[model samples]
Target: MLPSVVLMSALAVGALGANTTYTYTFPAGFNIGLVKSDELSSWCQGQRNECPSICKGSTKQNTCEPSTLKFNCVCADGSVPDVSPYIQTVPFYVCEATYGQCIDAHPNDAEGQRACKAAATCGSKNASAEDTTMSSTTTAASTTLAMATSTSASQTTSSVAAASATTNAAALFGLEGYSTGLMAGAMFFAARLFL
Candidate 1:
């Protein structure tokens, strides 16, 4: 009688779909195809470091990783409630990637700004500005220092390049000798076996 009651309760829960797992599968080549497809657009376009803002209401329920390359968005519980209705049929990966790119490009938070500015792409805009902007007084004082150091800097660069070239040549020769020794040993063994 107890087993019958437990079986009936299990059936009731299954009928309600309470514990059902939902998965969203993307079509093959969707990620690569997204490069050419302009149909789906991110809401955070032109906004830097704003990927996390997309999860305002569900901040605790979802994870947002903003990157200079792309923004990633996913449910913390790994259960994504169908956002298809809101996304104009865009795949979740596309949405996240787009958001991450925009967020990484336009960081608003201090840490994000530091990271974005440090990135190679953003460095030109952020670091180059500082490099190009020299105060007139400081530039005047450094003029003599630059003249004194230019020769040494050139010599240092030349020596470093020569060292790098020598290291590469030595590595190549070592690898070639190792390969030749192995082949010679294999051929000698084969000759003895056949004889």
Candidate 2:
């Protein structure tokens, strides 16, 4: 009877542990899909205190689960792996500013630069005084995303009304057309709110 009770307790604990959900909060404006896996690995290597090999291994290993789109640490036999060690959550503004900064610093990294610009587009330009580069990058990427979306006239107007008062024409439309430009602007505004 004692052995059976102990076995049941251990089984229950294991079952609960397997399904535990860990929520990792990413920056408000940053899109996980925009950045590639390799870029994340590279970022970890450069920014983390751990050895680059271990950082790279962490990324390569299935530590990052596809379901959550965030890394989870799973240790192999006799190995202790620190899962989710590389995530650095910053304010939306800082993340945008950093992306803009990275564009200049790492010119050769096209994917990283594009991902950074995409993130910046979803954030606000309120940090412009602190980092002009971020402002510029956000403007360019927002325009690109808007153009890719190519919002319709009615959609533009309704979206503009929904957008925050702080949103500006330049921030939304890339200054293309005073009337239709509002569409892109509103779309960007929406992205900031939701993404």
lDDT leader? 2
Cα displacement (Å) at residue 143, model 2: 62
Each model's C-alpha lDDT? Answer: 0.41, 0.44
* Residue 88, model 2: Cα distance from true site in angstroms: 7.8
* Candidate 1 ranges beyond 4 A from true positions: 1-141, 147-151
What's model 2's lDDT at 72? 37
lDDT of 1: 0.41
Tens digits of per-residue lDDT for model 2, 131-195: 44655689989998877677665577777776754367456565556657778789999999997
Q: What are the RMSDs of all candidates, in order?
A: 26.6, 29.7
Clashing pairs in 2: 63-72, 64-71, 73-83, 172-185
Query: Per-residue CA lDDT of candidate 1, range 12-126, in tens?
Result: 2333555433333433222333343333233223222222233322322322222211223333332334432233223333444444554555666777655433431210122
TM-score: model 2 vs. ground truth: 0.23
